[model samples]
Target: MTDTLERPVDAEPGRMNTRPAWLALFGAIAAFASAALIWICRAGDPSVHYVSQLGATGMPTAPLFNLALLLLAVAAVLVDRATIARGAGYVVGWPVATTLLVCGLCFGVASVITCSPGCPVPFTPGSLVQDFVHISFAVLGFVLAIVAMGQVAALRRRPWMRAASIITLVAVGATSLTGAMIALFKGDTVLGGNLEFTAATLAIAWFGVFGLQVFADHRTARRRAARSHE
Candidate 1:
């Protein structure tokens, strides 16, 4: 009798687990697609030091690229929430959630706050506060992205997730270092931009893959549960 009562309850999680994954997956696709469009639109612009620079005033692709960042931010938050819902909550879940939240909010704010034309050049003598704020948010968002990746790598039980997390960590680390170098030297803008683009791509890819995996895992679990019940 107890087994009969508990079986349905036990099956509930499996049945419901895929919902968050779907949300995350949608967010990932939106982020990546928008970012790609921005890059394509802004290609060959020498003045842009990083992807975020594309969203600065006077840039041709400013509005579109900024919109992309907003989409990516939303997607990141969804992915992080999904992680928490999956029962990895005790592990890296909370850390991932917090970092992604930071990433999302920073990105969203930075999108609205346009940088000066010559951003990453130490701000002009009388730059607007928005310029500095944009830089701060971008830097913090990237850093949190790296932290989230590391935590996910350390705590995820799935082999594929660990592998993806490790790869993302490497990509994000290289990108962050390259960005820092650009900031210090104010040189190699192209290289810095490329690295930033790559890092963003890897981040969205990881989120998409992770969400798909979670969704697939839950679907399998549900199927198995249904069979067992039969």
Candidate 2:
């Protein structure tokens, strides 16, 4: 118990290792996949309305996928804890490292919502706003992920991370532009489609990478802490 509290102080101040990062990353990938699948399952029509009803009582395979999402969230939490252990700045008003932790809850809740035996009844076209809300949370979380990554990248001075940061910054720019383009060209389905796709994908993938990094780093920090205490 004593060891658990102090373990974070033992890591390379703000550095996280690589092994566990992939684990959480795979989990993050699963999270996006599950969210997409669940959305498709509920989608009465991708264009206008998304039906909440899953058609059948329950999908047998869904259980496994939902579990996968849950696992990814746990992995994310572990990583977030590690960032905190390393004294990684939260950035802005909130702690950036903790965003990954919050995303775990978001993904878990989304999974549970998907797991319900029946989809939401009387699906309204207006529910598109709900979808937007989900996207907003994801975006907010991803922004924080970048903050954490920046800290890690700064501490390590890794070239790959530098490249990743540059790409991510561009993604952030393009994502916002795409989202606006989607709203602007509501009539022109072609451009809107491309914009939405680009923005949403970048947002999901960014969060996904951050989630994995947090999981790997935090777990390693814990191990190092225990060793130091011994």
Candidate 3:
């Protein structure tokens, strides 16, 4: 028999779920974490051509991403323990550390192989090849963004939340495709190189936001859980 006693109190008309509200909050955390990862990677060296700047800028990138990835990995699994995504989320958690290590190695190698001593010249086939290699890491970032945004959309409360999640997902996919194109057309030409890099940076920032949204979603979810309990 259905237990009326177990039912939560009368529904509040426009109130959002504590869980969902908490979920929305996770998005912000994830975004900041991603930015942190970028800084970690870039912190190494500034004078040399690195991830975005010159030094170890890419250093923070990996660590920050791992932080957000871990957070999303943890909460996503909890919220959908019965869903197929639960299995996927668990898989995501284990890879967080590996991703940082692998991305670091790939980017570092690419950096060295691409440019001669620093990364001043730019063109060299070596650099192109390196860019190609690093593309895979970028692809992973894109994939994770897709899943994170979709998950949020599925759990969102406000109409705008769903809209934002979907828009971000679409942007991630489009940016990835464009990034691939940019990777293919590398050179010293100001038009090609700068444009591609600008696009890539924008895409990365977008992915950062995707992580933020994921954190926000988690916060919203926790809130809902608390509300229900009350």
- Which segments of candidate 3 are over 4 A away from where they belong? 1-30, 33-135, 146-158, 182-230
**C-alpha lDDT of all candidate models, in order:** 0.67, 0.49, 0.40
lDDT of 3 by residue, 113-205 (tens): 322223232355434444444344444544554564565455424457567767766765674556456545653343443443443344345
Clashing pairs in 1: none
Query: Could you say which candidate leads in lDDT?
Result: 1
**What digit string (tens of lDDT, one per residue) describes model 2 on residues 127-226?**
4444443444444544554554454444333356546756776775675566566555555554654454554445455556655555555566556655
Off by over 4 Å in 1: 1-18, 44-47, 93-95, 120-124
Task: Identify the candidate with maximal TM-score.
Answer: 1
The TM-score, computed over Cα atoms with residue i paired to residue i, of candidate 3 is 0.41
TM-score of decoy 2: 0.50
